[model samples]
Target: MNGVRGLLGVAVCTGLAGCAAETGYADLEAYLDAARTQATVQLEPAPTLRPVPTLSYGASALRSPFQLPVGASVADRQGAAVPGMNDPARVREPLEGFDIEQLQMVGTLSGTAGSFVLLRGGGVVYRLRIGDYLGRDQGRIVAIGDSRVDVVEVVPDGAGAWLERSRTLALKTHS
Candidate 1:
């Protein structure tokens, strides 16, 4: 009876050990399967964030109809050098300088000379000659297209007094 009881005790202990081992094996298999599935989850690069498409209040406004405000402060985004950095007060000379302050065309230098005469402030101030040295474009009396203009040139016919004369200075435009 002692031998049988000892054998039964040993058998019971062995069965419990087997059961625990089986359970441990099953837990390990489950853990391995979970790890493999996670490894094969197919990870890809993250998508980039894009700007949203938006509309303005006046979507049809292609260009500004008004001119930009003068002396307005503006930030230069592009790294371009400022133009005309040499001269700040440089300005191109005008063609003719004559004030209409009670000014009248007296006469040019020569009678057939293509010059302009301007009487300003009750005096003959400028007798703009055709080939008078000036700035860029040479000042010349030419018929602009087909416009009829009346100009006057002074004729010094060996006379002491320069007689006030009239000549046509026309500047016509093509239609």
Candidate 2:
């Protein structure tokens, strides 16, 4: 038994020494050293932005820049009554309740009475003529042509004044 134990101890010590003396990792160690020397990274500085300049608007006393320019005549500016103003006593027309854009010119008619235009709105067809009022904006028909109907509309100019503007309703062409 003593001899067997002594041989086992010698074998263990010899195996440990053999493992420590081995040089199988020489290439791995050289590669690591070369990589450490070659590895390098460069960083760039961040960009800086300039501040925007501030401006102050001081046109409160003058006319507003956003409001439409008032083209009222001198008489109108002098407190005279403006033409095309809605009359309170006049009866409103059925087509006046509809917008000019909503009414499509469907056809035209000419007879002994006068020239007339047929307009369709809200699933109903209405006959109109020059001087007839239509649209919610107090629009009055001024002319009826073969392909379009011209109307003069009274609209507020954003300055407590009313202005007359021309609007055209084109005839609906079948697709």
Candidate 3:
């Protein structure tokens, strides 16, 4: 019965395959159907990414990991807001009239917003990360370690600069 069913499936698929033209004409037809003026595909402009807001580290933000709300402190925590996220004192006034361009990204790490790789413009280059660096010389990262990163790449987090800075992690584990 299984052999007969398999043969039947193949016969049906072969009939269907022969019934339709294999050529891809849909895209060309859609292109031709549009008014000639607008039909020309203008490359969608690369989105203007709001420059990553500048960050600073200093004595005012001195909280230890043990003292933090989640037991992990701001130190070495990347993307940290200095005083607070929505403090009125930080900005002179609410920013309005500027459009926020939401970027479509090919995500690297699988999670919430914590650690994700961003592909800005379409077909743009990707900087390699941890798993990408295994057994390759181009993967040589100068600072930080696997345990130190929320994701693979090392970021300049200035909690204890020496702790995460200037340190090197070799690709191979030394015996």
TM, every model: 0.21, 0.61, 0.17
Error of 3 at 76 (Å): 33
lDDT of 1: 0.42
**Number of the top lDDT candidate:** 2
Residue by residue across 74-117, what tens digits does model 3's lDDT show?
Answer: 65454443222233563321111111121122333444533423
TM-score of 1: 0.21
Residue ranges of candidate 1 with Cα displaced over 4 Å: 1-60, 67-102, 109-118, 131-175
Superposed Cα deviation of residue 87, candidate 2 (Å):
0.9
In model 2, the clashing pairs are none
The 10-residue segment with the lowest total lDDT in model 3: 93-102
Q: What clash pairs does model 3 have?
A: none
List model 1 lDDT by residue over 50-127, tens digit each: 999997787465545443335532232123332322235744223334322233334334345443543223343444
